[model samples]
Target: MFAPRVALASLSGESDADWAKACEHPAGAAFLGGVALDEPTREAARAMVDRDRDEFLPEDPVEFVDDQLSALDDAFLRAGVNVRTVDLDPLREVTEVCASHDAVLEVNAHCRQDEMCAAGAGESLLRDTARLCEQVETASDAGAAISVKVRAELPDVHLPTLAQAVERAGADAIHVDAMDSRRVVRDVSDATDLFVVANNGVRTREDVFEYLSYGADAVSVGRPSRDPEKVRAVYAAVKEWFL
Candidate 1:
């Protein structure tokens, strides 16, 4: 899991510069991006892919991904912070790159974009729990520390059941974007031994503490991460709590 308890959540357009900046912060870990693994996956993310999107990695997806991951590994090596990459792709493709780079492989099931859903990749996977579990198992079998990121409020998606499925599939962690429902985090935590990461709207020490108190092993910051001060505040809050 992470130390300090605060993680920089996967932002759409996070750049190398963004990674560098986050490296200097006190957050326990930095999730690089929800990048696309192939042309199809990239196409599925088209609507959200802007110049700022992490999907803008390289012209050749695999090479570019490998290179970027290596760069992150180098950059964060001395910082003692974990580098995790989130991506939308088949399990095989994702596990290959993550294994090569020695980075954590997080499956992206939290995105609700229409394009992604149409591709049967993002939130669409929620309705297909079997597929999601398969992805986690595939990644885990490939020697990667697997993280399954899911949205808590998806229709008909039972948070605890999904968490148990992910755990049974060998996922090392469950990243929950628990929108307004701390109960989702609590339920998932109670259902499995997987490291629980609570995400969304976490801006202050109080927010971090609230999630942790609800059984999250770590808390993540998303939109608020655009501001370095907020990231710092979150880091300080986590640090203070640990002290």
Candidate 2:
């Protein structure tokens, strides 16, 4: 529900308050850390780091979220956090912090890391729709405008159906990583009323237009988010097209 309708998707270890501030201008929404909340998820994050993968493993995750949002007190764009955890208990507290900051708590069902899946987080949630919806409902009940980050093209996972289940579970938005199967954006868009934010390979204005044409309410820039020029170009594309 942002003006230009472009979002900065969360990067594993890189996305934080400073990162959000740096890229906040042109984009309408910026999602912060894919922070690992519970112990299992945090331990998996450590394993990822051992493999040279980036991750956010703060000692006090709920407090970390508070500090991150507090640092962005003056930012004009909406801010959110993409969180991962195996247990549902932590979401309530973390989401409360998100609500206090007027931010969205994005449940991460999109991550594909083997470690994350083994911890029963990330893409594993895709295979377990019930658990994913429960996570959504947990955050939603905590007074958060919750969003669920989901990826398409996973085996046996019908995104449209998953989208419907989440919508029924009180999610406000669906951040779809339309990996390879771009039409999944349209399918999910067609199936539900959730605000759809399409992601993946979004580098140019044309890419922005492509996702918009597929019925995406907004398009997110992932890898090139650090490239201000590219993010600006995509933002300009959305502004120009929407205007």
Best TM-score among the predictions, by candidate number: 2
| TM-score against native, each model | 0.87, 0.98
Poorest 10 consecutive residues of model 1 by lDDT? 77-86
Best by lDDT: 2
Cα deviation of 215, candidate 1, in Å? 0.5
Residue 30 accuracy (lDDT) in model 1? 64
lDDT tens readout by residue for model 1, 1-243: 656677777766564435645544566666666666655566765655552334553566556556666666654421111222224244566577777766677888777777767777778888888888877887788776778888887769998998899899998888899987877898899889999989988986788888888898888777776777887888787777767
Task: Give lDDT tens digits, candidate 2, residues 122-211.
Answer: 999999999999999999999989999999887899899999999999999999999899989999999999999999998877888888
TM-score of 2: 0.98
Clashing pairs in 1: 13-52
Instruction: Give the Cα lDDT of each candidate.
Output: 0.71, 0.92
